[model samples]
Target: MRIIIERSNLLRSLGHIQRVVERRNTIPILSNVLLKTEEGAGLRLKATDLDLEITETAPAEIEMAGATTVPAHLLYDIVRKLPDGAEVKLGLNEGGTQMTVSAGRSNFRLQCLPEADFPDITTGTFSHSFTMKAQALARLVERTQFAISTEETRYYLNGIYFHALEVDGASRLRAVATDGHRLARAEADAPAGVEGMPGIIVPRKAVGELQKLLGEAGEDGDVAVELSDSKIRFTLGTVVMTSKLIDGTFPDYQRVIPQNNDKALTLDRSTFSAAVDRVSTISSERGRAVKLAISDSQLVLTVNSPESGTATEELAVGYDSDAIEIGFNAKYLLDITGQLSGEDTVFMLADPGSPTLIKDGGDEGTLYVLMPMRV
Candidate 1:
């Protein structure tokens, strides 16, 4: 292959495609990025690690149309270090096996693999295809991705669950994720004609890649999404990302949310979050439990540890019910607090050791459940 591409465009595509390349590969070809030049005006760069793949095309001046593979990370670093606006020229040696890259005063040679060695991805069989605003997709990931399970044994909880639902006679799209300790559920009005799409479990790696791509596409741009029973794809302008779905059934999370919690406390979000963090210093590492003491208009957060001492902080809240004492993990409390984009947060409590429900003071479509800890 002999092609010339702008330095900035080449570097950007490298940054996106190289992320899917594994650092250590049993097969040498898997460590390389495949570069193919078409008969027309652009070059396509692809990288994969069996589980995920990223393909992006950049406009280039092609003298000869061909394909070759080069070490992904090394090539990316070389091009990135070059001066901006410089033109990058790539060519195959006389034997057509060794590849050379040149830009500015720097030059490098790398071993190449044939195009037939790269794994082919079949994107023609998607059962569902839809489009939505990039900002909406980014918001869905930001609102619920933190609750994804890190435990390897419970494979079903390892990713966000995307499904279609109906709310108030209107279609809605929802993203749900949970660890054993907490659950986060967020929903938005589904785009028109996206009502009957089947549910899919998007693995954690794919979620991360989509997040990065969406960030680059900006908030106003729209993204096209395609999915099959076994794979998912996201297309943003000239970039495309595809990955295999996690083959596991997610547990029904609705049963765990408490429906009858009568006691409610509304507090300034920053004040409550600060109190929880300040008092939890005395909590033991195992439980990290902080006790909540609520009265007429005051709330107290206390943490007691046998090894350490005790710490307490008080806050003024909107509560007018009987005194209620409850315990919760400090980490869980912080997770819920960090998800808040509003000034005030509401907490509904049932008892000392039951599940507590939390939501933004003004929104009902997003709800969280945190299991309490014993004090």
Candidate 2:
């Protein structure tokens, strides 16, 4: 294929498609991106790693209509290093085994593979579809993705669980992620046609890719989502991404959320997070646990490590319940607290042994459950 494309336009599209191409490949064609051009449709770029596929189109001036495949990373790097605003010209060699890239004074030839060798990931009929603001979807991902498990044994917990639920007497779309020790849940207004949508586990990779696209679209832009039993597709502008959904069922996360945590501690989120950070400096690198002592309106944070040292800090909070002492992983506490956007954070506790519930006093749609750690 022969085409002339603006450097900026080509670079943007390449940045999105190349992410799907694996750095290491067992199949030759899988490491390359399929580039095709048509008379009126412009240039089409596609990349896939068997489980996920992303396709994007860029406006280009077409001189010839054909298709070829080239190393995705190499092409991206070439375009990225090219001077801004320069026009890029691409053409297939006469031998059909190489592709030539020309921009300004730079010229490079890259080995090419036959486009026919690329695998097609067919997106079957979708049973459900919905549209939501890109920002809303981004918020859902940010609030819960950090809690997704990295372990592979319980594959179901390796991604976020998305489903429809009734929260505070209103139906909403909720996303939940957990790694046994901690869990995060966030909700947004349920969009139309999602009332009976089946609970789907969106694998970690797809969530990350979607987040990148959404960030580019901005908050006001809309994204179309299509889902089937085995696959899910997201459409953002001219870019289309499809991913295979995890087949295992997600564990019921509600069972672990504490219902009757009688003790409540309300404190400035910034103050609490700062204290935790300071105390964790002296915590052991392995455990990194911080102890919290809560009584009346006083809260104290302490960390003790055999090799480092012992550190303690106290802060005044809004607490009226009986005294309670709990130990928690400092990193886990920081992660959950970082998600709180409001100034004040509330912690609901039942006892030292029970899981503690945390919420941003202002946002009822988001909640976190953190398991206690032994000091």
Please provide TM-scores, in order, for all candidate models, with all chains considered together. 0.95, 0.98
Q: TM-score of model 1 relative to the true fold?
A: 0.95
Candidate 1 lDDT for residue 312: 90
User: What tens-digit string does per-residue lDDT give for candidate 2 at 3-82?
Assistant: 99999999999999999888999899999999999568799999999899999999999998999999999999999999
RMSD of 1: 1.6
Off by over 4 Å in 2: none
Q: Poorest 10 consecutive residues of model 2 by lDDT?
A: 115-124
Candidate 1 structure quality by residue, lDDT tens digits, 151-186: 999988889999999899978999999998999988
Report lDDT (CA) for all predictions: 0.88, 0.93
- Which segments of candidate 1 are over 4 A away from where they belong? 281-286, 305-308
True lDDT of residue 67, candidate 1: 90
User: Which of the numbered candidates is closest to the native, going by highest lDDT?
Assistant: 2
Q: Quote the lDDT for 151 in model 2.
A: 97
Backbone clash numbers for all candidates listed: 0, 0
